[model samples]
Target: MKANVVVIQALEAQIAELDARLLQQAKLRPEYLLLKTMPGVGEVLATIIMLETGDIDRFAEVGNFASYARCVKSAHYSNGKKKGEGNAKNGNAYLIWAFIEAANFARRFSDDAKRFFEKKKAKTNSVVATKALAHKLARASYHILKEKQPFDAKRCFA
Candidate 1:
């Protein structure tokens, strides 16, 4: 038990050091500041997002960004008939994790996000609702990064 505790402490220290380094690097990027303007996106999340999504302009549209983040459903359709699923694992796994983390935080802190989450949860299960919220956040982040603008709750939650 003592050994386990010691190992956990050492790992935490290493994680803290790495997080500080990431923050230092993220400070040089404008997108980090932009992403921080959104609710639930603090230093860690903003850094993860800015680092994971390099050159937002590479995505021509929000849908493309969302798809890249794995926030959208993946399905193969042929002639309106449902076929096998698409390559759901094609996008960045880190991004999906980050967005889901942000969604969990946003629903707790932001009223707009909470309302949106509740509405979605009413229709679907909690997991789906959280994913929906993550999808919304992903799309919002795309615009925020591409346009170099702060987050607008009205525009996003509306």
Candidate 2:
């Protein structure tokens, strides 16, 4: 038990050192801070989103960003009958992870977010509700990055 405790402490110390080094090395763009204005996003999530997104102008539209983030569902329809979905294994997995993490944090930390999630959860399942929230956050983040504007919870949540 003593040896295990020593090992765990050493690992934790290493992790903290690496985290500080990453913070020092990263060149945080203005958009990184703007990304944090959203309900859920913190330093880590904002950094991930900003770095992974690269240039926001590359995405022509909000839907394009959402699609790239894999927050939007792929659908296949034939004669108005739901057939199947396209390849689900497309888009940036990292962005999806970040957005989903943001959504969960938003739900836990903000009353507005919790209310919105609850409303959606009442109509749908928890997983679906969370995805919906993530989708919203992804689109909002795209606009925030593109416009170089901070997040507006009213515009985003409402």
Candidate 3:
């Protein structure tokens, strides 16, 4: 029991040390501060987003960025008939994870986000609603990164 407790404490200390180092590196990037302005995105998530989305200019449009983040639906259709599916797993998995995580937190903290999530939930299942919210966040983050501006809930949720 004592050895287990000691091991847990050592691991906790190592985690804290690594977190501090990550924060130090994140602070050096201006995009980190911009990303942190959004609801539900904290130090770690902002760092992940900033690192994963390197050079936002590479994306031609917000849709492109959202697609790259795996936040959009991947479906292939010809005319009015459903044919097949696109490569849904082609984008950054880490980004989808981060955005979905952020969406969950945002629904709890941001009123606009909560309202949007509930509305979407009413129309679809919880998982779809959550993914919809994540998609919104991904698109908003794309604008934030490209424009180097803070997040605006009014603009995002409107």
Candidate 4:
């Protein structure tokens, strides 16, 4: 039993080491670092953003990027009346997941982000609140990287 336990531990360590190597090989580049510098972002989410989005130029505008992240609401309209449910399943799933994680982190570490999240949640569900925060983060990321400027919390919140 002790030998089996040792083997299991060794396997777990190997898996972790491989994961680190894969992340390193992912090649997040510079923009990813800027994303990482955001309040809620970390290496994992940064990598996801880099791998999933590739060049930001692919998006004609930041709004396109935001839509690709699935952060925007989808509404169906027919003759000025609401139609069937619009699809909410577009863009990179990994990016969406990363943004959600970033939002959660921001809620914990950033006072402004937390306030916004709380306010949103007061009126909507927790998921909506998180999505709102994530959308803000995503938009900020696009502008900051485009302008080659560091993230500014005041401007971001404003």
Which numbered prediction scores highest in TM-score against the true structure?
2
| Candidate 4 ranges beyond 4 A from true positions | 1-15, 78-81
Off by over 4 Å in 3: 1-12, 25-27
lDDT digits (tens) for residues 26-68 of candidate 4: 8667787777778998777777776787777888899999999
lDDT of 1 by residue, 113-151 (tens): 999999999999999999999999999999998889999
Steric overlap count per candidate: 0, 0, 0, 0
- Model 3, span 1-158: residue lDDT tens: 99999999999999999999987766457878899999989888899998999999999999999999999878888897889898878989999999999999999999999999999999998999999999999999999999989999999999
When summed lDDT is taken over every stretch of 10 residues in candidate 1, the lowest stretch is 22-31
Candidate 2 clashes between residue pairs 3 or more apart in a chain or in different chains: none
**Model 2 poorest ten-residue lDDT run:** 18-27
Q: Rank the candidates by TM-score, best first.
A: 2, 3, 1, 4
The 10-residue segment with the lowest total lDDT in model 4: 142-151
* Pairs that clash in candidate 4: none
Cα lDDT, all candidates: 0.92, 0.92, 0.92, 0.85
